[model samples]
Target: MSASPLKILLCALEPSADALGADLMAALRKRCPEAAFIGCGGALMAAQGLESLFPVDRFSVIGPVAALQALPAALKAADRLADLAEKEKPQTAILIDSWSFSKIAAMRLRKRAPEMRLIKYVAPQVWASRPRRAQKTAELFDGVLCLFGFETGYFEQAGANTRWVGHPGFQAILAHDSDKAAFRARHNIGAGPLLAVLPGSRAAELKRHAAPFRGAIEKLLTDFPDLRVVVSAAPGAENAVRALAAGWPGGAFVVEGEERFEACRAADAALAASGTATAELALLGTPMVVAYKVELLTELWARAVLTTPHVSLVNIAAGREVAPELLQRDCRPERLAAALAPLMRDGPARRSQIEAFPAIARLLAGERSPGDAAAAAVLDWLGTGKTP
Candidate 1:
């Protein structure tokens, strides 16, 4: 008789999480070819053989206030996930990113299916904000697969079994071997100055950042007329990205879908929305100015909880200002121009960012592959042999 397939209920609520889930699913499949997945995920995981119980788009909104606005929808998604977990009774449930939604669903799942081994992929930046979230995580998850090494110890201290799995975001950068010159040539971009503009992958993020990023570009255009612009359009954020990219004073080229990383590789510098792409920018050794804007109410409360001095993960890992982060009013066009101008050209700020990449890569890429490491951790938690 054939061995029973390991049943996993995996939930990923954003682009970054979806990609991680896809990678983990592949790694797990190699070990347990008959493993079946049931939960929510995007195209990548679906392609990796996850036929989700519901669409992934339902849980897309991010950030504090923005996430609050989507609470009703998010709650519905969370409830449905809990219901699925109760009915399916998967041996394990791996909640990837999306803390708010994951927390709600996890809590309910634990109550409904106490036997399910709950694992959380990508620990929250409790080191950055909401330190007590570690305690909350301990209460919610049986195990947490962390991307950073420090996170493993931090959460372990909080009474949860957490493992260091490096970071898939940085690994994506390390694995990608794109030729900048060829990429630039293909895009018909001259070497004088190429700017990569990333206004984030979510609708709320694009809505908040597109105008300021555009204004910054316009401001730079006055000083550098020959500057070439490439906007990194997030998958599923096409219309929003087009609306924003279309308005750039000096025409901007949009790179979406699979080509986004190529655009990152070709850019001289980037004005990016503070997220996973920052890791890619750092991996490509590109100088960057990270910008983020949140609703006033959210920013006000976030400041209180946020303990880290830097916002960009690259800088956070480096323990210094590798990439300058402009948040709230500091993310204004004039301030953004001031921060980005030096990066667009060769300067100390830009050089510092470049110097920081190797360490970031080293810190993120442990001895083993991040995706595989995360998968092994999950399998071990499931009492399944961790071998393909």
Candidate 2:
């Protein structure tokens, strides 16, 4: 008799995880054509044949206050995921990012189905804050697929099986054929110095970043009257981003979906939140000023725990601040504008930042695409109890 198809569960709570989950699914399909996927993810994952149990956006909360407000709903979602696991009985479950949600789900699944293997697609930044989480995560998940080489040691030290699967962001950004002229013509923007503003993808991030980003743009306009602005909005955050950009000094152009990459490539400089966008901008060779703000409580908590010298991945990888970072109190408009001024022109400051991009890119590169590497790791773990 023929064996049944492999059933795999995937859970991704945020936009970035959703993208990672989708890539993993596609790569898995290529290797194991008969694999079946279920559980929760966003649009991209849905395209890869995952019928998500619920809308992932409901759990995309950030900061302590937002997390507290969404706790009840999050608990309910965890239960629903557990119930789904009981019913479907997949052989393996891969929990992507959204550490809080993933932890809850993994614990619930462990209680309900001890035999099923649990894998974590992205390791928490335990090296940055909450070092104990490495051991906790080790106890919960059977294996961890790390996005960076540096992450593997933390997980391995905690006794978790690990594979350095690389980061999909690098491959995705490097693969894009960005057309500067096309993006400008589509938005009716002139050849003047263009600034790409990436506030963030989550609602809370948008809320925290919108005001200061707008203020910074206003200041930039004073220096370069012809400066054009383009705001790249993540899928669900498009409308919010558009409204926020509407009042910018020169009336910013808002691009969603794939056009965001084009905007990033076309811009002379960017004002971005200190997250994945900063890394993406770096990979695209866009000189930028990174800024971030959070709730007072969250900021205090983060300050108490964070061990990393820099928040931006580019800066972290470079071991120095390649792009200027204006954070917390310094995240004001004037500071942001000051940091971006030198970057907007073709000068030593801009060249210095751009010169570091190639090295950062090389640091992130892996033998294969992240999706394929992750899929191979999972499949190998299932087959021979080993991972690459």
Per-candidate Cα lDDT values, in order, are 0.83, 0.87
Winner by lDDT: 2
lDDT of 2: 0.87
- TM-score to native of every candidate shown: 0.75, 0.77
lDDT of 2 by residue, 1-388 (tens): 0155789989998999999999999999999999999899999999888898998787887688999899898889888988888898888899998888889889999998777889999899886778898999999999998887667888899899999888876777788897889888888886889999999987788888888888888888999999988899977888988887786776677889988999999999999998888888888999999999989998988889988888888887777888988998999999999999999999999999889888887666555799999999998888874432
Predicted structure 2, TM vs. truth: 0.77
Which tens-of-lDDT digit does each residue in 158-230 have in candidate 1?
Answer: 9988888987656666787778888888878767788999899888899899778988988998778988899
Model 2 alpha-carbon miss at residue 91, Å: 5.4
User: Model 1, stretches more than 4 Å misplaced?
Assistant: 1-26, 32-117, 201-215, 218-225, 247-251, 362-367, 379-388
How many steric clashes does model 1 contain? 0
